[model samples]
Target: MGLLKNLDPLLTADVLHILRSMGHGDKLLICDCNFPAAEVSTKTTTKKHVIITTSLPPVIDAICSVLPLDYFVEDRVQYMIPDAGLELPPSSVDVKNLFTAAIKKHSDTSLSGVERTSFYKESRKCFAVIQTMERRPYANLILQKGVVGPDGNDLKP
Candidate 1:
């Protein structure tokens, strides 16, 4: 009997497999609640499977267990629609805070802000996209992977 950090089979399998296939410079997109994942996937250069969760913790829990976020570059943070266009989402804070907490749980993390178009551009390069059915809008984010120390105690080790 093998013991995995995350016991959930679906989460354990999908996230683990996806992260394994990625190397440096590969992107992993963790989208906010209202990012219309199915719609935006059309433009992606990937064949990814996403797992959507209503709360931020589970999404964070699932990902952090399998992959280490890129610390060299801040996680890419982008609003759904700019202030020049539409109102902000009510749950943006929760979404933002959740991501902040998730990275803080794993490594020294910061975030980078990108315009919608720029975010979409970077997203296309992702190895996979994990969508959370969070109720908050503008919670879309992209994470890059950084190196792990030689301690042999990480997802790769």
Candidate 2:
């Protein structure tokens, strides 16, 4: 066991596995509560659930405690469904507010959204996909792993 690493026994095996596989520049997704995180996280090399929000903010908090999601590369806009016929969840104002607050509290890090397909692709690459069990809409977020600074701090983009 190391000295400074966060230790929590309740962590799922798949989540731990995903965290183990992650390195700088890798990605991890804390998907919305409705996303199929459990099923999907099993396929990844590393993943974990921080258990932050029922909708969005808590997810951010859980993630920030361990992950420094800086150095992310995403379009500075929210990702949307491609087809007009696609269905959407009921609206909740928490999506952006919680998301922004979560990242901000962690560091100078910021968030950006990508298309649904793109976000899905990112989730696949993520070490783990954490589902929040939130009942809110548009609560999904993808995180990118960034290098720790020379002082061994998380890098912010």
Candidate 3:
């Protein structure tokens, strides 16, 4: 039996370590199967690809449970938009909903949209990349880490 209670089984020791090691302002990418995670991960601080055998929503939920969202940045949470325009793909909408619900109590931060190419460029700078089994198109998101104060609330401006 695992020592951590109410933690998602998918969050293994390695995954928890990655999350715990992240500092404020560090970025974490939660992406779909087609996200080129291995290639992109090579450029991240962790230099490793962490695979979670699950869909996007649960993965987002699990990560958000422990990881705080950056309140200092305007773009604390970001989703990929089709190159054509800012309209979010169906999968991205689902991602947005889950993301918003996950961090609502911790942050009032809003989500931003990054174009396909820009998203890829920004992702290369992430601290870590978590690839999920989600097959939906544009099911990708980037979360910026925030400081959790002594009282357990995220530090806000």
Candidate 4:
């Protein structure tokens, strides 16, 4: 109730709690429709509960608006790369652009692409993963948390 009314429904109480509890450098995974989010969340070392949000873009936009992306790292945001020899789908391209624009709205960090297996492996170490109803292939992404500086800006490396 306290300030929850001001946030997006996708950013539910549990989601807000998760975000608030995360420390700097903690990673949050955004899973696509095809991703085994329940299975992955269970297997994660953190043993988090997967929060399935509305869709990829809205969830990304909502979460990115409040969470600071890790500016100290070379890559604050990372998308999963399609299998070797396979190109990213059109929807994935659009989702990537959405992520870029959302982050650019608050900070200067950009997105990087990691191999499929590496992405999944990294997901296992994340604080939590939010599964979306996005039907696009290779739409998964991970955002690392950054600290807020004295000036209320994302502290850069």
* 1-157: candidate 4 lDDT, tens digit per residue: 5555567777877788788989999988888878988888886646676556466878888888789778778978888997678888787788778766866776676678998988999888888878888887787888999998888878875
Model 1: pairs clashing at backbone N, Cα or C within 3 Å:
none
RMSDs, each prediction?
Answer: 4.0, 4.9, 1.9, 1.9
| lDDT (Cα, 0-100) at 143 in candidate 1 | 69
Off by over 4 Å in 2: 1-21, 46-55, 72-90
Ranking by lDDT: 3, 4, 1, 2
Model 3 steric clash total: 0
Q: Give the worst 10-residue stretch by lDDT in candidate 4.
A: 44-53
Q: Per-residue alpha-carbon lDDT of model 3 for 24-115, expressed as tens digits?
A: 99999999999999999999988968999888887887888788888888999998888874676676677667756765644667888888
Candidate 2: give its CA RMSD in angstroms: 4.9
Give Cα-based local distance difference scores for all models. 0.63, 0.59, 0.85, 0.81
Q: Candidate 3 at 16: error in angstroms?
A: 0.5
**Where is model 3 poorest over a 10-residue stretch in terms of lDDT?**
99-108
Write down the TM-score of every candidate: 0.75, 0.67, 0.89, 0.89
Predicted structure 2, TM vs. truth:
0.67
lDDT by residue for model 2 (29-102), tens: 66666777776676666545444335556656655666644455443223323334555544645466666776
Which one is best on lDDT?
A: 3
lDDT of 1 by residue, 52-142 (tens): 6566556765666556655455443333344455555556666677766765676555566666767777777667787877766667777
| Stretches > 4 Å off in candidate 1 | 1-10, 74-87, 153-157
